[model samples]
Target: MFKIEVAKMSILFSPITIGGVSLKNRIVMSPMGMNACKAEDGKVTNWHKIHYPSRAVGQVGLIMVEATAVSLDGRTDPDDLGIWEDGQISGLKELVDMVHEQGAKIGIQLCHGGRKSKIPGKIMAPSAIPYDENSIVPEAMTEEEMYEVIAAFKESARRAKQAGFDVLELHAAHGYLINQFLSPLSNKRGDKYGGNLENRYQFLKEVIHEIHKVWDGALFVRISATDYHPEGCSIDDYIVYGSMMKEQGVHFIDCSSGWIVPPNFSERPGPGYQVPFASQMKKEVQIPTGAVGLITSGLQAEKILVEGHADLIFIGQELLRDPYWPKRAAKELNVSIDAPPSYEYIWNK
Candidate 1:
């Protein structure tokens, strides 16, 4: 009698580890601003309670909660979640416990809105430029103010640990404060915090240095790998940035693009449009990368992993559209994913 052996599952559904943390699979829900916190006080609400754990129940390996402000003034909007104060810890801890109970790991993206803040106050930036004609010119951060923001990140990291997060991501992307320092199009300082690329990297390097003092868990940096303008950071520049981050003990580079300033050229985004950024970072910088941007299907995600383009697949808007995207992806990819005990019967049938 002849026997046939079945092929193993897709790498998209395979387990991988980063920064000493083990995830059951490689699917990471990208951090998107939800603006759903309680009463605009920067606290998690029941909306988060339902929003996050449902993805875990749907079998997403990891869920990165939205970009959370590291300081009250750092918030992008009034309703954004925050980690700036101790009072917010209990609410976050409750959410963490819920995600963990559903067998998913959780991470929080620590951010400062900088010039992008819409909370009716003076925003801060590396330079005093407005993001657009409609926006106000932000105060270029003084040396003292820069130190304060760095300290805020460190304190927030400590609060995240207290809240029991498995990972912490620094939001250095999408034209935020850190991205403002990173991109030439936005940062025009002549000091050590700007001018050359090394100087431009100093702010983020210092921020990470301070965060390292408190965060011992998985540390990831989400970066806008390109600004899509001639004056902005290029892929080659990100290779250098990725290397610097790796030296700082960063475990993963979440590859994304644009928003450093408005692009001169239009972006024609489609499936895996940003995977090349991740692939280049992994190849040249020798660090793991999480690919985000327009990646929508499990088969597409699987191909990316199989081809060594990226180490993790970050699903964004798609996850919001269908909380069970992971389980559905499993079915589409002809792999099996463990569902919640209560949902097993439904999935099985």
Candidate 2:
């Protein structure tokens, strides 16, 4: 059922299994902050149902929900969905079910905003550096507080399971709680949680341990492959961190970059800017990885897979701008896609 036409570059449409979850194709719908939650307590809302099922109907392999706060205090926006409460599970369950019905797998991204924590006005970080003036200063988490956050992550994963999500994506990227731990420029603590790569990775490793116990599903981790700042997290550090994450049973490293700091020349920014990061990680670390960043074309995405640059490609804005991106791609590349017999008349000819 799958042919890896390397020369014709058709591997992008091949089936692959991540951890134990099989994907219909290699295309993933990467998480983008929609901030569309409408429930008072920030539970997944009807908008989520509408948002994700459409992607599945469009034929993407994996649909990763936006950053979901593991704790109330960790929320990045009032509208951001939260897994901290059991009340939020059923709505999300409905959303996941809808996606599955469309023959798509759904993953929920668990996150802690740290200094970027946009819980009302409260933010908590590894240090006091502000994410924005309007953003909360976020008192450094004490050991007790840190432990609480870890528990929070575990509980969130438990809730996600109860919601019937297929995967758990740890949002360790973008200068959030986990990113704060990894960045020397952000983490100034002299404690075991801050000084070196091992120390910086400690909190995340433990969080993974916690979530891992509760989530029997594939556990994917998103990483900023480059800090994009000369003084910040580096490619060297990223590889070290990726190796540690792999040892922790992370199923795939979703390659992303530059949210922890401003863009730097070190980051080769443009279309497919972050593909090299995924390529290098897969080559050196030998772990399954996903490439995401301005991936806009069927051929462009296919080349990444054909050349072994990434195991998966995610289309963000492109899909949003055109919910039928998959169908269009199928047509462009002369590939067949599944559509119910009733809808054949409605397909873009």
Tell me the number of clashing residue pairs for each predicted model.
0, 1
For residues 180-266, could you state the per-residue lDDT of candidate 1 as single tens digits?
999998899988999999999999999999989998999999999999887789989989989999999999999998887775655
Clash pairs of candidate 2?
123-138
RMSD of each: 3.4, 3.0
> What TM-score fits each model?
0.97, 0.94
Over 55-147, each residue of candidate 2 has an lDDT whose tens digit, in order, gives 888888899999998887788877788888889889889999899998989999999888876556556788877765565466877999899
What 10-residue stretch in candidate 2 is worst by lDDT?
1-10
- Score each candidate by Cα lDDT: 0.91, 0.84
The local distance difference test score of model 2 is 0.84
Q: Which stretches of model 2 miss by more than 4 angstroms?
A: 1-9, 132-135, 264-268, 346-349
**RMSD of candidate 1 to true structure, Å:** 3.4
